[model samples]
Target: MAAAARLAVAGHRVTVYERTRTYGGAVGRLERDGFAFDTGPGLLHLPAVYRDLFVKTGKEPLERCVGLTQVDPASRHVFADGTAVSLPNASRAGIVSALDTALGGGAGERWGAFLNRARDAWDRSRRPLLEEPLPADVRPFARDPYPALRTGLLRRPAVTLADVGRRELRDPRLAALLESHALAYGFDPATAPAAAAVLPYMEQTFGSWYVSGGIRALADAVYERCRARKVEFVFGTAVTGVLVEDGRAVGVELDDRETVEADHVVAGAPLPALYREQVLEWESTDEWPRHQQAVRTGRVTVCLALRGAREAGAVHRTVVHSTDREDELDSLARGRLSERPTVVVLRPDDERLRPDGDHESVTVTATVAAGGAWASGNLWGAAGGPAVEAFADRMVEAAAAAVPGLRERLLWRVVRTPADTFRETGVFQVPGPALAGAGGSLLPAANPAPPGGLYFAGGWSHPGGGLAHAGMSGALVAGLIVEGAGFRGSQ
Candidate 1:
């Protein structure tokens, strides 16, 4: 929608073909018995990407379009050892103070020092990795940019996020705190690049935000913006193939065998292999943004509609770290269910989401493996049997640490697993923000595919997943389409 709006504003007639009846690919809401829950991301970060989009494409800005507010304490984290800390939103001093009070020692200072090094990385690769196009030669980005502290007898650098936390922070609890950020996005911190430090740095620096009605409201606003730009949306339609002629994409073939001819074709990564094969070719060499066979991760969401009102001082978001990180990760890699998985609990203090003052809505989420053994009926046997419910039980048990009297609240709960996700969307909707290490394996395909006039956008392409990165991809695709291949990103 962002790309379509921008293109429409530039006098290009735009049409969006949506396979589903509604828009907002993954950002959705579940409403049951007057209680509503955000099925996707509970919060927004680095909202400036959307702000920039609204400013460039329409008269009404993002703030005016959606009720955007910064969360006070960005998040509360509960570690395995029964330690809880609330990090204030975008306030470095407040975070340091809270961490020092909770963890004692110089944990706060150590974390601060780490953020300083992370800032160096954010400054160095902010453009090429995000604001600009992915170059054909990814060698520059393949090098990790994180300035990890020199350690060991030979002064070797930290290779991964896990190494960074253990070698630099030097505290198990603090290490868990650092790694939790990566785990939230379904990335294994042990193998994730140390350059992933930018994730926390971006959140803490820009602060976390919430849309009044849910994250879905942001999508609604974007869709409305696209509509206002005179962009036509063809819903309940699927493009079965892209028509590539003379080494250029000139149109798309619909599921009904009908073809819509166009001057350009913009594709998203989540589209089936048909669109992928037609848009870009697979090459092992220096051709950038090649398709990768990833062992993607998926999420399990449990929504609890309670009968009682929310507590007065309940935090909006809380993360309960896994008890056994290694075992949990091992199970995830092996495509087995983790007994005690890390769970994220969200209790939004919004009245509209509940039945009334006497009712509350809570959502618990956990990241699990996707499309391996899971595809072989391990996650849930066809119709969602006991295995899926048991996994939700584990998540609820973990979330109880955040929400007081969670079980006592006594309300019905709905469990949505990766099986449900695959059944509905036919994909896991996983992977996270693009990073600068791991041989550029984390980065998605670039905006402009090998076939001229064909572009890629959304979470699956350049800059990877998340709302901000997805919006950035749309902007990059728009820039490439409007200003031609030489176009750099937003100034």
Candidate 2:
């Protein structure tokens, strides 16, 4: 919708072909008995991307379109050892103070120093990695950006985010604090490049934001913006494949054996559907982007239609770190279900999400394997199967620390596993944002890919996923379309 709106504003007649009868792809919402919950992303980061979209496309700014709130104490982290810390929203000094008081032993200074290095990484890659088109020679971005601190005698460069954690943070709890940021995005800190530090840097710097009703509200606003710009939407019809003519994409072939001719086709669909349908293909296996791998991790969202009222002092977001980190990561790696998965608990203090002040909506989520028997089919109405239900039960248990009496207050719960994600969005995995380093192993496919006129927007494309990165991808696609080959990116 963001891309459609931008293209429409540029005087191009835009038509969005949606597979489902909705606008938002992954940014979906669930409603039951007046209780509402965001089934996709719980919060928004780098909101400036959408703010820019609204500014460029319409007279009404983002502020006027929807309500935005900066979550105070940004997020609370509950480590395995029962140590917890509340990092203030976009306040570096406050975060340092809180970490010192919570974790102790110069932990604050270490994290602060890491942030300083992370800032350098952000500065080095911001223009090329983001806010611009995917460069042809991605050599610069193929290297680590996070400046590794020299430590013990047997020192080596911090190759992964985990290395950065252990070498620098030094405390298990503090290391958990750092790794939680990466895990939230479904990145294995063990393999995610040190450039992955930019993830936390972005959230900590830009501050975590929330849409009034849910993150879904932002999608609604963007969709409305597209409609206002006269962009067309063909819902309930799937684009089976991109129609290629003379080595260039000219239009798309609908699933109904219908052909829609156009100058360009922006495929925002997941890669599995894209490749399976042969919409976009590379003759050589090496021709594909290095980072666009088969991501196995998918999210499990449990929406609790609780009976009790939300407390005035409830934190918006909380991360309950897994007690056994090794087991958790190992399970995800081997496609096995973890006994104890790290859970993210969201307890928004919004009257709109509940029937009244007496009711509250809480969302609990965790990452899990998405392939094979794990995400075979839709598990929503399966009488709460053993695997999903048991996993959800663990998630709810972990979330109880954040939302007191979580299980007791639950009037009803709806669980959306990887299968549901695959069913709804056509892919089980939730893509993380593109990052620099690991020899471009962390980067997503370029926007202006082979066989011109077929641009890949959304998470599966150049900028990767997340609300902000998805918006950036939309902007990049718009830029490529509007300016043709010379679209360097917004200045």
| Per-residue lDDT over 362-445 for candidate 2, one digit per residue giving the tens place of the 0 to 100 score | 888888766632345433336547878888888888888888887788899998887778788767778888888888766888
- By lDDT, the best candidate is 2
Q: After superposition, how far is residue 103 of candidate 2 from its true place, in Å?
A: 1.4
TM, every model:
0.95, 0.95
Model 2 alpha-carbon drift over 4 Å, by segment: 281-291, 372-384
Clash totals, every prediction: 0, 0
Number of clashing pairs, model 1? 0
Q: What's the lDDT for all of these models?
A: 0.83, 0.84
The Cα RMSD in angstroms, rounded to one decimal, for candidate 1 relative to the true structure is: 2.3
